[model samples]
Each structure stands twice: as C-alpha cells, then as structure tokens.
Target: MNTSATLLDTLRAEVDQSLRKFLDLRRPLLADPDLAPLLQAADEFLAGGKRLRPAFCYWGWRAAGGGPDPAIVTAAASLELLQASALIHDDVMDKSDLRRGMPAAHKRFEALHERSGWHGSARRFGEGAAILLGNLLLLWSGEMWRTSGLAEEALDAAMPLHDHMRTELMCGQYLDLLEQAEGESTFEGALRVALYKSGRYSVEQPLRLGLTLAARGELPWMERLCVEYGRSVGIAFQLRDDVLGVFGDPAETGKPAGDDLREGKRTMLIARALGSATPRQAEDVRALLGDPALDEAGVARLRAIIEETGALAACEEMIKRYLDDALASLEQAPITPESRQALTGLAIAATARRT
Candidate 1:
C-alpha cells in the first residue's frame, strides 16, 4: 500500500481509539440514564468520518520536527469532536434530513420525540436537543484537548490559534447564512464564505495547530509554508466539496444527490454558472433552486445548466490550479523528506477525493 494511505489508515484507527477512550472516561460524569441516549448519539455521530483534520494536524507536527508521540495523536483526535459539533449544528441549520446515509441529528431526536409521545412539537424538540448535543460536544472537545497529555507549554502555545479557529468557524457560518438570505452571491463572495466557513478550519488551522504545538511557537518559515501550501489546499478542498455536493454519488458521499441545490448553497460553482447563464437558464435556476420539493428532474436540469454554462469546468480548473500551487510550495519546505512526501500525498487526497 502507498505510505500516505497506510499512514492515514493508521491515524484513523488511532483517532477512533482515542475518541472512544476519551468518551469512556467522560461516561461517569454524565452517568444519568436519562442522558444515555445523548451519549449514544454522540458515539454514533463520531463513528463516521475521514479523520482528515487529525491527519493534517499529525503531519503538521511531524513537519515541524516533532517526534512520534501518542499524546499528539490524542490531541489531534480532539479535533474530531470539534468537527462533529460543527456538523451537527450545520445539519440543523440546513434542515437536512440525511447525514452519512442515516437520519440527521435533529431528525433522530424528532423521531425519538414522536416515538415516546412526549413532545408538543417533535420538530422543535429535535432541533433543541440536537443544538444542546452540539454544544456538549463542543465543550468536550475543549476538555479533551486540554487533557490530551501534551506538555502544558505546547498546549498553551497553540491555545490562541485554537480559539481563533473556532471563532473563524462561527463567523464563516454566519456569513454563509447571510449569503443565503441575500439570495444571490458573487464568485468572490462565495469564495470568501468557503475560505472562512470550511477551508480555514478544515485544513489550514489544523495544520497550524499541530505545527505550533510541536514548535512551541510559530516560526517565519512555518508561517510561510502554512500560508502558501495549507491555504491553497484548503481552498481547493472546499471547491471540490462544492462539486461533490451537487454531483457526487449518494453512496459515496452519504447524502442525497444535489443536496446543495436543495439547500440553495451559494457556492462558487453556482455563482459562476449564474454569471454566464442565459436569461431562461437563470430563470430556471431561480425557480428550482432551494425548492424543498425538488425532484430528480429538477436536479438534472440544474446540473445540465451548470455544465452548459461551463461553471463546472471552470471550477475544476480552479481546483487544479490551487492544488498545483500547493504542491509547488512543498518543494522547498525545510521539513523531513518523509513528511514532505506525506504532505504531498495529503494535498492530492484532499482535493481529489470523491467524498
């Protein structure tokens, strides 16, 4: 197997184990039977992810001359909890019904309410419960990071970046909401939303967190590499995600086809399409986009319009350019050869992945 693939698989297993151990340790604190379901929900939600953020963090540590240590893995795994918290809240905001091929957190809670005959409004109850669950996970993420056994100095060094990352995530999310409310967005506007909402936290900040932890502080070269490499890959990763949100296979992505269309996400792809669309094509988009009752036919029409307008091709080109820029930046990074190779592999995987 490829070394990067092997490393990613190993990291995934280790992260999963770390998460399980952390959750087990916390079980006693929330031991009330009434909260059993909440714990179970957390477990289930944490079970399915690519573990990419943790991998990026681990490799960033390695790139900064950090030696192999289990403590770093534990610390990196805490990112998964943060990711889960964000995803749970994101699903509620989008009013999405499915996540990872299963009912979304809110939907599950709503069903629980209905099944028990215990709520005035199952929908409201579900949304409330899911929100609380997301908050709990966010709290646990901080606790896990603090207690991951890394040296106090290292944790302290990285703390500011950690706080900033979460703040940026919230800001990005609010920008996304504002964009949706405004109905249409320019390519630049959509790109800004992508960078802040998903790109920064997903790749750059995680890598920075790891690098800072390992170095006990930031260096000029480290900052340069992260900006040149990490930022480019992060943007490309989000662009690919925009493509997948519309065109990816359901089985692979674990979401309904054209879910982005249904949600009316004002992604860069949509912006590009609208920028060049004919009057009738634009009219069709306005009519069908965000329709809760959108069907496969509507999805197909929108897909066709996106393709005919060359938006899809333009987006693909942009992804390629950004990915190339990232890979190019890696050639001169003063990191270990093994880490250099691994980072190269990670860059490709992030932008080229189907899911």
Candidate 2:
C-alpha cells in the first residue's frame, strides 16, 4: 500500500478509537429513555461516514508537530462529530434520501418512527428528531474540544476558527437552500456556496487548528496559503461530487444515478451547463431542475444534456487547477519535509476518493 493508504488506515484506526472513547463518555447519558433514542439516532447517523474530516484534523495536528497524544485524538474526533452534525442537517435541508450508502438521517428517523409505532406524524417526527440529535452532536463535539487539555492561548486562538467553520457552514447551507428554491442557478453562485460551505471548514480551518494545537503561534503567510490551498481542493471535491451525482455508477457511488439531478442541486456542473447550453439544452435543464417526479429515463436524458454541454470537461479541468495549487501550497508551508509529504499525500487521497 502507498503512504496515503497507510496514513488513511492509521487515521481510521485512531478515529475509531476516539469515537469509542466518546461513545463511552456518552453511554451513561444515553441511559435515559428520552435521550437514548436521540443517542441512537446520532450513532446511526454517524455510522457510515468515511471519517474524512477527522482524518484531515489528525493529519493537520501531525503536520504541525503535535504529538500523538490521546487528547489530540480526542479533539480531532470531536471535529468528526461536528461534521456528522453538519451532514445530517445538510441532508435534511437538501431533502436528500441517501448518504454514505444508507438512508439519510431524517429518513432513518422516519423509518424508525414507523417501525417503532411512534405517536406523531412520521415525517415531522423524523425531521424534528434528526435536527435535535444533530444539534446535540455539535454541542458534544464542542465540549470535547474545550476539555481536550490544550493550552489556554491555543484554545483562545482556535475558538474563532471553530466558530467560523460552523457559522460559514450554516450560511453556505442557507445559500444552497435559497438557490434551490429560486432556481437562480449560476456558476458564480455555485462556486460561492462551495467556498463558504466547504473550502474553509474542510481544508483551511483544520490545518490552522492543527498548527494552533502545536503552539506554533501561526506561521508566516499560513492563512493565505491555507485559503488558497483549501479553496482549490474544496472546489475540486465538490466538482467531483457533482460529476458523481450525474455520471457515476450507482454500484460504486452507492446511490441511484442522478441523485443530485432529482434533488435539483445548484452545483457547478449544473450552473456551467446552464450558462453554455443551447436554447433546447437550456430548456431541458430548466425543465428538470427540481422536478421530483423525474423518472430514470428523464434523468438519463438530463445526464445526456449535462455531458454533451461540455461542462464535465470544464469541471475536470478546474479540479486539476485546484489540485496543482494545493500541492504548491503544501510545498511552501514552513513544516518538516516528512510532515509536508504526509499532508500532501492526504490531500491527494481526499481529492482522489472514488466513493
């Protein structure tokens, strides 16, 4: 296996351990009948995630020369819980049905509602339960971080980044919801959402948090470099996701084809296709933007239009540009060569994931 694979294995093991730690801590709290259901929901929601955010957090800690302390693992695992909360909320907002190869959190709740013969409307109960559980996970993540034994200065410096990540994530989600409702799908609009929703939180903030934890007091030009690097990689990830949403095999991606199309996601692929489409092509896209009733044949036709519009090539080209820039940023960072290599490998793995 390659170094990225090795690091990924290590990251997974560490995150699994940390997750067990957290579950142990929360086990007693879940003993309450009212809270047990919520905890179950949270745990199920977290079940199939790839642990990407926590992996990034750990690599960030390592890249900054932060030792492999159990406390650092605790902090990084907390980040993953935050991500889980965000993802659950995001799925609810997007009205998506599947996530990480399983029913989305809200859907799972709804199913549980029916299976267990809960009293309220299934949809309402599911959404409400998922939302509250997601909020609880976010709160627990923060508490874990605060109690993770970092220095005072480090905590003070890192808190702003943490807050920014949550705030910007929510704002990005709101922007997406607005775009979907209005059908104001544009390339710039999509890119803006990607930046706020993913770029900073996923890439830049994790790296900065790692450095802060190491007590490095912020390196020269770190913010700019991380932003540039993060924006590039983050956009690439989203673009790739857009591609997968349309063209990927369901067996590999673990979702039905055209899931995003059915959801009417205002992604870069959709935006670019709309901008360059002919009148008929444009009409085709507009016709299906949010048509929940669209069947497989309709989805197939929509996929054909999106591909024939050449937006796929544009998206791929853009992904490459970001990848190059991110690698360059890693080279310029003032870190040990080993750490830089590890970070670079992880970045590549993140951008290159097929499922």
Q: Any idea what lDDT model 1 has?
A: 0.92
**Candidate 2 similarity to native, TM-score:** 0.94
Q: After superposition, which runs of candidate 1 have C-alpha atoms over 4 Å from their true positions?
A: 353-355
Best model per TM-score: 1
Q: Which stretches of candidate 2 lie over 4 Å from their true place?
A: 353-355
- The clash numbers for all candidates, in the given order, read 0, 0
Candidate 2's displacement at residue 108, Å, is 1.8
Lowest lDDT 10-residue stretch of candidate 2: 216-225
Tens digits of per-residue lDDT, candidate 1, 1-355, equal 3587777778789999999999999899889998988999999999998888998899999999998899999999999999999999999999999899889999999999999999399999999999999999999999999999999999999999999999999999999999888997599899999899888888899999999999999877998888889999999999999999999999988899999999999999899999999999999998998887899999999999999999999999999999999989999899988888788888888889585
Clashing pairs in 1: none
In the range 1-355, model 2's lDDT, one tens digit per residue, is 3466776777788777777777778898779786776777677666666676776666677766777777777787788888888888887876788877788778888998899997879998888877887898889989888887777777787788788777888888888788888888788898987777776677667767776667547766567656766567777777777788888877777677888888898889888888889999999889886787879888988878777888888888888888998888778777766567667776776677475
